[model samples]
Target: MRIAVALFEDAEELDWAGPWEVLAAWARQFPEDDVEVVTVASHDGPVTCAKGLRVLPDHTWETLGAVDVLVYPGGVGTRRELADPVVLDRLRTLHAEETLLASVCTGSLVFAAAGLLDGRPATTWWGLVERLGELGDGVDVRPDARFVDDGDVVTAAGVSAGIDMALHLVARLHSVERAREVRRYIQYDPEPPV
Candidate 1:
Protein backbone atom coordinates (compact mmCIF):
# COMPACT_ATOMS: atom_id res chain seq x y z
CA MET A 1 0.00 0.00 0.00
CA ARG A 2 1.29 3.42 -0.94
CA ILE A 3 0.35 6.29 1.40
CA ALA A 4 1.16 9.85 0.43
CA VAL A 5 1.06 12.68 2.94
CA ALA A 6 0.51 16.02 1.25
CA LEU A 7 2.59 18.90 2.49
CA PHE A 8 2.28 22.55 1.59
CA GLU A 9 3.45 25.96 2.70
CA ASP A 10 2.11 26.91 6.15
CA ALA A 11 0.74 23.43 6.89
CA GLU A 12 0.35 22.77 10.58
CA GLU A 13 3.44 21.00 11.89
CA LEU A 14 1.72 18.37 14.02
CA ASP A 15 -1.15 17.84 11.62
CA TRP A 16 1.09 16.00 9.16
CA ALA A 17 4.01 15.03 11.38
CA GLY A 18 1.86 13.17 13.89
CA PRO A 19 0.35 10.96 11.22
CA TRP A 20 3.71 10.57 9.54
CA GLU A 21 5.22 9.33 12.81
CA VAL A 22 2.51 6.72 13.18
CA LEU A 23 2.27 5.60 9.56
CA ALA A 24 6.01 5.65 9.00
CA ALA A 25 6.46 3.52 12.11
CA TRP A 26 3.99 1.02 10.73
CA ALA A 27 5.90 0.81 7.44
CA ARG A 28 9.22 0.44 9.23
CA GLN A 29 8.04 -2.21 11.67
CA PHE A 30 6.20 -4.31 9.11
CA PRO A 31 8.32 -4.27 6.02
CA GLU A 32 6.58 -7.45 4.85
CA ASP A 33 3.31 -5.58 4.74
CA ASP A 34 4.57 -3.76 1.65
CA VAL A 35 3.49 -0.40 3.06
CA GLU A 36 5.23 2.66 1.69
CA VAL A 37 4.77 6.09 3.24
CA VAL A 38 5.97 9.25 1.51
CA THR A 39 5.61 13.01 1.88
CA VAL A 40 4.51 14.89 -1.23
CA ALA A 41 4.24 18.51 -2.15
CA SER A 42 2.89 20.43 -5.13
CA HIS A 43 6.45 21.24 -6.16
CA ASP A 44 9.92 19.78 -5.69
CA GLY A 45 11.17 22.62 -3.53
CA PRO A 46 11.25 22.74 0.27
CA VAL A 47 7.93 23.51 2.01
CA THR A 48 7.86 25.94 4.89
CA CYS A 49 5.38 24.76 7.49
CA ALA A 50 3.08 26.92 9.61
CA LYS A 51 5.64 27.02 12.40
CA GLY A 52 8.47 27.79 9.99
CA LEU A 53 9.86 24.24 9.74
CA ARG A 54 11.29 23.55 6.29
CA VAL A 55 10.53 20.11 4.87
CA LEU A 56 11.85 18.61 1.68
CA PRO A 57 9.13 16.41 0.30
CA ASP A 58 9.83 12.91 -0.98
CA HIS A 59 7.97 13.59 -4.18
CA THR A 60 6.08 16.29 -6.03
CA TRP A 61 2.50 15.92 -7.26
CA GLU A 62 3.76 15.51 -10.83
CA THR A 63 6.16 12.77 -9.75
CA LEU A 64 3.79 10.77 -7.56
CA GLY A 65 2.29 7.58 -8.95
CA ALA A 66 -0.94 5.90 -7.97
CA VAL A 67 -1.47 6.40 -4.27
CA ASP A 68 -3.59 4.03 -2.21
CA VAL A 69 -4.19 6.71 0.38
CA LEU A 70 -3.66 10.47 0.64
CA VAL A 71 -3.29 12.39 3.90
CA TYR A 72 -3.96 16.10 3.50
CA PRO A 73 -2.78 18.18 6.42
CA GLY A 74 -4.34 21.51 7.40
CA GLY A 75 -3.25 24.98 8.43
CA VAL A 76 -3.55 28.58 7.31
CA GLY A 77 -2.17 27.53 3.96
CA THR A 78 -5.28 25.47 3.34
CA ARG A 79 -7.15 28.74 2.84
CA ARG A 80 -5.29 29.24 -0.41
CA GLU A 81 -5.70 25.59 -1.41
CA LEU A 82 -9.44 25.86 -1.00
CA ALA A 83 -9.53 28.16 -4.00
CA ASP A 84 -6.78 26.46 -6.02
CA PRO A 85 -8.26 24.95 -9.16
CA VAL A 86 -5.25 22.74 -9.74
CA VAL A 87 -5.39 21.28 -6.25
CA LEU A 88 -9.13 20.79 -6.40
CA ASP A 89 -8.94 19.06 -9.78
CA ARG A 90 -6.20 16.78 -8.57
CA LEU A 91 -8.26 15.85 -5.52
CA ARG A 92 -11.31 15.23 -7.65
CA THR A 93 -9.30 12.95 -9.90
CA LEU A 94 -7.96 11.08 -6.90
CA HIS A 95 -11.47 10.61 -5.58
CA ALA A 96 -12.64 9.31 -8.93
CA GLU A 97 -9.75 6.87 -8.87
CA GLU A 98 -11.07 5.55 -5.51
CA THR A 99 -8.05 6.59 -3.49
CA LEU A 100 -8.78 6.77 0.22
CA LEU A 101 -8.81 10.46 1.16
CA ALA A 102 -7.98 11.63 4.66
CA SER A 103 -7.70 15.14 6.01
CA VAL A 104 -6.57 16.77 9.23
CA CYS A 105 -7.79 20.08 10.64
CA THR A 106 -8.66 22.61 7.93
CA GLY A 107 -7.62 20.20 5.19
CA SER A 108 -11.23 19.12 5.04
CA LEU A 109 -12.07 22.61 3.89
CA VAL A 110 -10.13 22.00 0.72
CA PHE A 111 -11.93 18.70 0.26
CA ALA A 112 -15.22 20.48 0.78
CA ALA A 113 -14.28 23.13 -1.75
CA ALA A 114 -13.30 20.38 -4.18
CA GLY A 115 -16.78 18.87 -3.79
CA LEU A 116 -15.32 15.72 -2.24
CA LEU A 117 -17.16 16.19 1.07
CA ASP A 118 -20.56 17.03 -0.28
CA GLY A 119 -23.21 14.89 1.42
CA ARG A 120 -20.46 13.17 3.40
CA PRO A 121 -20.01 12.78 7.11
CA ALA A 122 -16.84 14.74 7.99
CA THR A 123 -15.17 16.86 10.63
CA THR A 124 -12.34 19.35 10.97
CA TRP A 125 -10.77 21.67 13.51
CA TRP A 126 -13.35 22.37 16.18
CA GLY A 127 -13.36 26.05 15.40
CA LEU A 128 -13.97 25.37 11.70
CA VAL A 129 -16.81 22.89 12.00
CA GLU A 130 -19.37 25.51 11.07
CA ARG A 131 -17.15 26.74 8.26
CA LEU A 132 -16.88 23.23 6.87
CA GLY A 133 -20.64 22.90 6.88
CA GLU A 134 -20.90 26.20 5.11
CA LEU A 135 -18.43 25.15 2.41
CA GLY A 136 -20.05 21.86 1.38
CA ASP A 137 -23.69 21.10 1.00
CA GLY A 138 -25.00 18.56 3.51
CA VAL A 139 -21.67 17.90 5.17
CA ASP A 140 -22.50 16.25 8.49
CA VAL A 141 -20.13 18.12 10.73
CA ARG A 142 -19.24 16.28 13.88
CA PRO A 143 -18.02 18.81 16.37
CA ASP A 144 -17.11 16.33 19.07
CA ALA A 145 -15.40 13.70 16.98
CA ARG A 146 -11.65 13.51 17.11
CA PHE A 147 -11.86 11.71 13.81
CA VAL A 148 -14.63 10.33 11.65
CA ASP A 149 -13.98 7.33 9.42
CA ASP A 150 -16.37 7.28 6.47
CA GLY A 151 -14.87 4.47 4.45
CA ASP A 152 -13.00 6.18 1.58
CA VAL A 153 -12.88 9.57 3.25
CA VAL A 154 -11.68 10.04 6.80
CA THR A 155 -11.59 13.44 8.46
CA ALA A 156 -9.63 14.25 11.56
CA ALA A 157 -10.50 17.03 13.96
CA GLY A 158 -7.25 18.77 14.71
CA VAL A 159 -3.48 18.52 14.88
CA SER A 160 -2.78 15.75 17.39
CA ALA A 161 -5.92 13.97 16.32
CA GLY A 162 -4.18 12.93 13.13
CA ILE A 163 -2.10 10.52 15.22
CA ASP A 164 -5.23 8.74 16.32
CA MET A 165 -6.54 8.71 12.79
CA ALA A 166 -3.28 7.32 11.44
CA LEU A 167 -3.23 4.55 14.05
CA HIS A 168 -6.78 3.77 13.09
CA LEU A 169 -5.67 3.55 9.48
CA VAL A 170 -2.98 1.07 10.42
CA ALA A 171 -5.52 -1.10 12.19
CA ARG A 172 -8.02 -0.83 9.39
CA LEU A 173 -5.55 -1.64 6.61
CA HIS A 174 -3.53 -4.28 8.45
CA SER A 175 -4.54 -5.84 11.78
CA VAL A 176 -5.42 -4.66 15.23
CA GLU A 177 -2.39 -6.48 16.54
CA ARG A 178 -0.15 -4.78 14.02
CA ALA A 179 -1.53 -1.37 14.97
CA ARG A 180 -0.96 -2.15 18.61
CA GLU A 181 2.59 -3.14 17.86
CA VAL A 182 3.18 0.11 16.03
CA ARG A 183 1.67 2.11 18.87
CA ARG A 184 3.87 0.28 21.38
CA TYR A 185 6.93 0.86 19.29
CA ILE A 186 6.16 4.53 19.21
CA GLN A 187 5.32 4.58 22.94
CA TYR A 188 2.30 6.75 22.23
CA ASP A 189 0.56 6.58 25.55
CA PRO A 190 -0.85 10.07 25.73
CA GLU A 191 -1.36 11.57 29.18
CA PRO A 192 -2.18 15.19 28.82
CA PRO A 193 -1.49 17.13 31.96
CA VAL A 194 -4.06 19.69 32.78
Candidate 2:
Protein backbone atom coordinates (compact mmCIF):
# COMPACT_ATOMS: atom_id res chain seq x y z
CA MET A 1 0.00 0.00 0.00
CA ARG A 2 1.22 3.45 -0.86
CA ILE A 3 0.42 6.18 1.65
CA ALA A 4 0.95 9.83 0.91
CA VAL A 5 0.89 12.20 3.83
CA ALA A 6 0.10 15.73 2.73
CA LEU A 7 2.41 18.50 3.90
CA PHE A 8 1.81 22.21 3.66
CA GLU A 9 3.20 25.46 4.85
CA ASP A 10 2.21 26.06 8.49
CA ALA A 11 0.93 22.49 8.96
CA GLU A 12 0.96 21.18 12.53
CA GLU A 13 3.99 18.88 12.86
CA LEU A 14 2.48 16.23 15.07
CA ASP A 15 -0.65 16.04 12.99
CA TRP A 16 1.47 14.47 10.22
CA ALA A 17 4.45 13.18 12.19
CA GLY A 18 2.44 11.05 14.59
CA PRO A 19 0.81 9.09 11.84
CA TRP A 20 4.03 8.98 9.85
CA GLU A 21 5.85 7.41 12.76
CA VAL A 22 3.24 4.68 13.18
CA LEU A 23 3.03 3.90 9.49
CA ALA A 24 6.77 4.07 9.00
CA ALA A 25 7.30 1.69 11.89
CA TRP A 26 4.82 -0.72 10.37
CA ALA A 27 6.60 -0.56 7.03
CA ARG A 28 9.99 -1.08 8.63
CA GLN A 29 8.94 -4.04 10.73
CA PHE A 30 6.86 -5.67 8.01
CA PRO A 31 8.66 -5.14 4.75
CA GLU A 32 6.59 -7.95 3.27
CA ASP A 33 3.52 -5.74 3.49
CA ASP A 34 4.91 -3.42 0.82
CA VAL A 35 3.80 -0.29 2.58
CA GLU A 36 5.39 2.91 1.31
CA VAL A 37 4.96 6.11 3.32
CA VAL A 38 5.86 9.46 1.82
CA THR A 39 5.25 13.12 2.47
CA VAL A 40 3.71 15.09 -0.39
CA ALA A 41 3.37 18.81 -0.91
CA SER A 42 1.89 21.19 -3.44
CA HIS A 43 5.40 21.88 -4.64
CA ASP A 44 8.60 19.88 -4.55
CA GLY A 45 10.34 21.98 -1.93
CA PRO A 46 10.78 22.53 1.78
CA VAL A 47 7.70 23.76 3.64
CA THR A 48 7.92 25.82 6.80
CA CYS A 49 5.47 24.26 9.23
CA ALA A 50 3.22 25.82 11.88
CA LYS A 51 5.89 25.87 14.59
CA GLY A 52 8.64 26.88 12.15
CA LEU A 53 9.84 23.37 11.38
CA ARG A 54 11.15 22.92 7.86
CA VAL A 55 9.92 19.76 6.11
CA LEU A 56 11.12 18.53 2.77
CA PRO A 57 8.39 16.78 0.82
CA ASP A 58 9.30 13.58 -0.97
CA HIS A 59 6.89 14.26 -3.80
CA THR A 60 4.66 16.95 -5.17
CA TRP A 61 0.99 16.48 -5.97
CA GLU A 62 1.98 16.16 -9.62
CA THR A 63 4.52 13.43 -8.92
CA LEU A 64 2.55 11.33 -6.44
CA GLY A 65 1.16 9.17 -9.23
CA ALA A 66 -1.00 6.46 -7.66
CA VAL A 67 -1.44 6.75 -3.93
CA ASP A 68 -3.55 4.12 -2.19
CA VAL A 69 -4.28 6.44 0.69
CA LEU A 70 -4.00 10.14 1.43
CA VAL A 71 -3.36 11.55 4.90
CA TYR A 72 -4.15 15.23 5.32
CA PRO A 73 -2.76 16.88 8.43
CA GLY A 74 -4.16 20.08 9.84
CA GLY A 75 -2.75 23.23 11.39
CA VAL A 76 -3.19 27.04 11.49
CA GLY A 77 -2.61 26.79 7.74
CA THR A 78 -5.88 24.88 7.32
CA ARG A 79 -7.71 28.19 7.82
CA ARG A 80 -6.11 29.48 4.66
CA GLU A 81 -6.36 26.15 2.76
CA LEU A 82 -10.09 26.09 3.56
CA ALA A 83 -10.46 29.04 1.25
CA ASP A 84 -8.29 27.75 -1.57
CA PRO A 85 -10.44 26.48 -4.40
CA VAL A 86 -7.48 24.73 -5.98
CA VAL A 87 -6.75 22.73 -2.88
CA LEU A 88 -10.38 21.81 -2.35
CA ASP A 89 -10.79 20.78 -5.96
CA ARG A 90 -7.66 18.67 -5.84
CA LEU A 91 -8.79 17.03 -2.61
CA ARG A 92 -12.13 16.19 -4.20
CA THR A 93 -10.32 14.60 -7.12
CA LEU A 94 -8.07 12.64 -4.81
CA HIS A 95 -11.08 11.37 -2.85
CA ALA A 96 -12.53 10.08 -6.08
CA GLU A 97 -9.31 8.27 -6.90
CA GLU A 98 -7.90 7.06 -3.58
CA THR A 99 -9.10 3.95 -1.76
CA LEU A 100 -9.11 5.65 1.64
CA LEU A 101 -8.83 9.23 2.84
CA ALA A 102 -7.67 10.09 6.34
CA SER A 103 -7.33 13.41 8.08
CA VAL A 104 -5.66 14.50 11.29
CA CYS A 105 -6.81 17.36 13.51
CA THR A 106 -8.30 20.25 11.49
CA GLY A 107 -7.52 18.28 8.33
CA SER A 108 -11.14 17.28 8.40
CA LEU A 109 -11.92 20.92 7.90
CA VAL A 110 -10.09 20.67 4.61
CA PHE A 111 -12.13 17.58 3.74
CA ALA A 112 -15.27 19.45 4.68
CA ALA A 113 -14.17 22.38 2.56
CA ALA A 114 -13.71 19.90 -0.29
CA GLY A 115 -17.20 18.50 0.32
CA LEU A 116 -15.68 15.06 1.08
CA LEU A 117 -17.38 14.92 4.51
CA ASP A 118 -20.76 15.95 3.20
CA GLY A 119 -23.48 13.76 4.75
CA ARG A 120 -20.82 11.85 6.72
CA PRO A 121 -19.96 11.59 10.40
CA ALA A 122 -16.52 13.08 11.15
CA THR A 123 -14.44 14.69 13.85
CA THR A 124 -11.66 17.20 14.26
CA TRP A 125 -9.98 19.33 16.90
CA TRP A 126 -12.52 19.71 19.75
CA GLY A 127 -12.58 23.48 19.60
CA LEU A 128 -13.51 23.44 15.90
CA VAL A 129 -16.19 20.76 16.10
CA GLU A 130 -18.95 23.32 16.08
CA ARG A 131 -17.29 25.27 13.32
CA LEU A 132 -17.15 22.06 11.30
CA GLY A 133 -20.90 21.66 11.66
CA GLU A 134 -21.30 25.19 10.51
CA LEU A 135 -19.64 24.22 7.24
CA GLY A 136 -23.01 22.70 6.32
CA ASP A 137 -23.68 19.84 3.86
CA GLY A 138 -25.09 17.94 6.82
CA VAL A 139 -21.73 17.11 8.41
CA ASP A 140 -22.38 15.03 11.52
CA VAL A 141 -19.62 16.48 13.59
CA ARG A 142 -18.61 14.26 16.48
CA PRO A 143 -17.16 16.33 19.29
CA ASP A 144 -15.98 13.47 21.46
CA ALA A 145 -14.43 10.87 19.13
CA ARG A 146 -10.69 10.44 19.09
CA PHE A 147 -11.29 9.42 15.51
CA VAL A 148 -14.31 8.53 13.39
CA ASP A 149 -14.17 5.86 10.72
CA ASP A 150 -16.99 6.56 8.34
CA GLY A 151 -16.04 4.12 5.60
CA ASP A 152 -13.40 5.53 3.28
CA VAL A 153 -12.90 8.75 5.19
CA VAL A 154 -11.41 8.49 8.66
CA THR A 155 -10.81 11.59 10.73
CA ALA A 156 -8.62 11.91 13.80
CA ALA A 157 -9.11 14.54 16.44
CA GLY A 158 -6.26 16.93 17.30
CA VAL A 159 -2.54 16.09 17.11
CA SER A 160 -1.52 13.07 19.19
CA ALA A 161 -4.81 11.42 18.29
CA GLY A 162 -3.38 10.78 14.84
CA ILE A 163 -1.21 7.90 16.10
CA ASP A 164 -4.34 6.08 17.20
CA MET A 165 -5.94 6.71 13.88
CA ALA A 166 -2.90 5.43 12.00
CA LEU A 167 -2.90 2.22 14.00
CA HIS A 168 -6.58 1.89 13.30
CA LEU A 169 -5.80 2.25 9.62
CA VAL A 170 -3.21 -0.50 9.83
CA ALA A 171 -5.69 -2.78 11.57
CA ARG A 172 -8.30 -2.03 8.98
CA LEU A 173 -6.07 -2.35 5.96
CA HIS A 174 -3.87 -5.27 7.02
CA SER A 175 -4.97 -7.34 10.02
CA VAL A 176 -5.47 -7.03 13.77
CA GLU A 177 -2.33 -9.09 14.35
CA ARG A 178 -0.28 -6.85 12.07
CA ALA A 179 -1.55 -3.74 13.78
CA ARG A 180 -0.73 -5.19 17.18
CA GLU A 181 2.70 -6.17 15.99
CA VAL A 182 3.31 -2.67 14.66
CA ARG A 183 2.07 -1.18 17.93
CA ARG A 184 4.33 -3.46 19.89
CA TYR A 185 7.33 -2.62 17.74
CA ILE A 186 6.71 1.07 18.25
CA GLN A 187 6.07 0.61 21.99
CA TYR A 188 3.05 2.82 21.61
CA ASP A 189 1.36 1.98 24.88
CA PRO A 190 0.07 5.41 25.63
CA GLU A 191 -0.41 6.54 29.21
CA PRO A 192 -1.08 10.21 29.09
CA PRO A 193 -0.52 12.11 32.31
CA VAL A 194 -2.98 14.79 33.23
Indicate which candidate wins on lDDT. Answer: 1
The TM-score of predicted model 2 comes to: 0.97
lDDT of 2 by residue, 12-129 (tens): 9999999999999988889999999999999977899999999999999888888889999999999999899999998888788765999999999989988999899999999899
TM-score (C-alpha, index-matched) for candidate 1: 0.99
TM per candidate comes to: 0.99, 0.97
lDDT of 1 by residue, 99-179 (tens): 999999999999999998889899999888999999998999998999999999999999999999999999999989999
Q: In candidate 1, how many Å is residue 122 off?
A: 0.7
Q: Tell me, by TM-score, which candidate is best.
A: 1
Residue 61 in candidate 2 has what lDDT? 85
